[model samples]
Target: MPLNLSQYLHLRSVPSFRTILAVSVLLRVGLILYSEWHDAHSVVKYTDIDYRVFSDAARFVLHPTEGNVAQGPLGKRLGLGDPYTRATYRYTPLLALLLTPNEWLHPSFGKYLFAACDILAGVLMHTLLTSAILPHADAHSASPARDTDKHYARPSTPPSASPAASPTRREQLAMLLAATHLLNPLVFTISTRGSSESVLALFVLLTLHAAVRARWAAAAALLGLATHWKIYPFVYGVACLGVIGGERGVAQGWRGLVGQLVNWRTVWFAVVSAGTFVLLGAGMYAIWGYPFLYESYLYHVHRLDHRHNFSPYFYAIYLAYPTHYVPSSEPSVWQRVLASPLASFGPQMALALGAGVLFGRRRRDLVFAWFVQTFVFVIFNKVCTSQYFLWYTLFLPLLIPQLSMTPRRALQLAGVWVGTQALWLSEAYKLEFLGQPVFFGLWVRGLIYLAGHAWVLAGIMESYEP
Candidate 1:
């Protein structure tokens, strides 16, 4: 006989990272088996678009002299710059170099590599949460009675409430953080879809781990690598300073903070971070030339992909600035200035200003503040994509142990986030795959996404208030 509902719930609620990781592995194995049975080894002929693109680009990296590779299709250009020789290769050279095994061997190898990175990210998240953040949060939230429980729990204690049987706070948080990343549908999609987002996610979690452990140079180096992989982690610079400063108890005032920043450790972090960027960038330039920088980094600096994107800013640009709906490769200087806001400059500026104000408030919990910072960075981006959600998903679980949200509020937030994503993706599927006209519905979906994410950010700020 099958387990009843209560039994099922009891078993499911067990705080076991091993169980979560096992389920994650099973899901990944299914995806890999499916690919193998289909013999889908080539990039272009594969099912997942991003994976296909990554494989194709990796092929170019493996054999730069190959003359037969397609120069990407027209009208599908998302980033700016000169017409790319290999138009589909829009990511950093490091990513191409990383994906070379897919080109040299089989695409299945690439899928497995990404799966490994996905699992590695979960491991790093578990370590960060269980070893560091959870303990710190527990200490902060623990009361005298809670801390004294060990000493007071004798037979004379009268067995208060049957020992309050439940998983300890640390165990619950460890399972939650591990399972959130490992079992997240979005994480599975990106990993099996063959996107390098998993690699980026791994580096991000590692960077945070290093930072929390007071290994500033390691954190800075990892941050540099992450920034090269995806430009968004540049925002983490502010949060890094905050973390280091908070560690040194420099929150007395701005003057003390400024004085602390001039210390040797901060200088070392800066030197190491800049040195990493310079070395990696010089290597890429030598391998792929200026076009690598242009296509990969500069292109994204002014990118505006209105097609099938869910950014509210891009949606407004589509409806209001139809001429600027699709980006131009050779936009004039005047056009560039006029399109800055739609290109995400305006919102980025607003985010920078907001970060300044928040920092001024001297929020001492640097890790939690950094989580909020990264969350806002993703939500306010102009070119928000489906995979972009992974940015916060990686950090949110780490931050959860620190948050004070009630069970009801947490449920509401989770419901709103998942519901909005489902609704938006439903419309997106109709437009991209089902051959339906969803232009108007796209606007509605964008609004819903914006509102949902905005609500989440508001709640985070409220919970993490200084």
Candidate 2:
């Protein structure tokens, strides 16, 4: 049927599909080439705040025994004595692991390596999504079975088995997922920079992909790797176990459910993940001793307590006290006011537990899990840096295509993403809007943008049906 043919053709004919793929690939290549060119032209300078920290960390990793403190020993190196450090400094040991190898090469060359990893990460993201969405090739036409009438005559095997394997239905879904991510400006910007987010995103994707494919052990191992890299992916593991347990209960029995939870595969995954954490922690301890590990990793968790407000809440508080409002060197009065109850340890744990109870049942419920995790993290976080957008960027693509909204709704959401980047980029470039203050100062603009983000998130939440 021509209509059927049209449907098939349209799948591949989507506008901007090829362009999106090409541009994403080309931009990454260009960035690397440009960075290399710039480095060759002059001595590379650490201009960005993260760059300085990374450079110093790289030096430490290179000569750990030297005991030479470029910044300071681990505990003192953190903002214990420095106010700016308290406000801005946060450390993830995984970042140091990534940077250490790059430090072996010249720092500039090492940047190139990091950039290359980002490019590879981008490509992997692209492939992962493509594998999700594209339709499978016609196996018969491409296989030896076509030439052998005997093999085809009686159907020698089940439909599931064949010499040629076409892409599965899930793979087509992945392709669409990839398309959304490719178009995401935040993903584009983050991938271009020398951040661990691209890799972090890749690992998340891999873990999810493995989980969805029912590769339980592989999923666990990927999740373990992801946890070692960032720590948030552990939440995904909780979601996965919930789903597996639920599915097993329905399909098998209570005994089966219990057995599935304590299955060899699950045990192996737990061991692998735990072993990884212990090994990494041990390595950190060896390098800087237990105190340094505690300060850098454990104490770093409390760093968020210092953040007063970004745009979202700041605007509301500002309007309430327009005359009395004065930004202080210490935490804002409003921050303390809102902080007292929520910032308490018991409440934070309860909040996390509540979110887990809410969305833990569906492993395949990507949208719910993403929304819950992102919302909780963003709303409660002490600091909401623009780069934090990277945390949810990978999940956004998969969630976006599932929305039932009109194209206009989609466009509006897209605009919000664009606006977010515009605000951040303006700050980054020190561009003033007719003497208007930056994002940190434009409290009203931040509130409006926050509302837009909330609207999209609400759509996601409403779509989740238990």
Write one digit per residue (lDDT tens) for candidate 1, span 1-466.
Answer: 1111111233346647787788889999797777666545654433467676776666655553444322333211322122235567688866665667875687667788889899988888888766776555444443323322332212222222212222353555577667878888878867876777888888877887887777888889998888878777767766666556555564556677676556676677777887887788776665556676788788877665666687767655554443654554566565555457545666764675357335522323555655666666776777688777777767777766555544566677888888898899888888899889887887788889889988977776555423
lDDT by residue for model 2 (1-466), tens = 0001111323454544456567757776576556556655867532334655665665554453323322334434432221122223345444654666555665544445444555455455556445442222223222332223331122333335532233443344444555556656555545444555666766777777776666777777777777766655666665666566555443256566556556655566677766766676565554445443544456645433322243344444434343444555455676555444344344434554456544655455643575566555564444566777667665655554333344454566668766764664455354243554453555545555567666766655553323
lDDT of 2 at 338: 48
What's each prediction's TM-score? Answer: 0.79, 0.65
Q: Candidate 2 regions off by >4 Å?
A: 1-25, 36-47, 64-66, 69-94, 101-106, 109-185, 250-272, 304-353, 416-448, 463-466
Using TM-score as the measure, the top candidate is 1
Query: Clashing residue pairs in candidate 1, if any?
Result: none
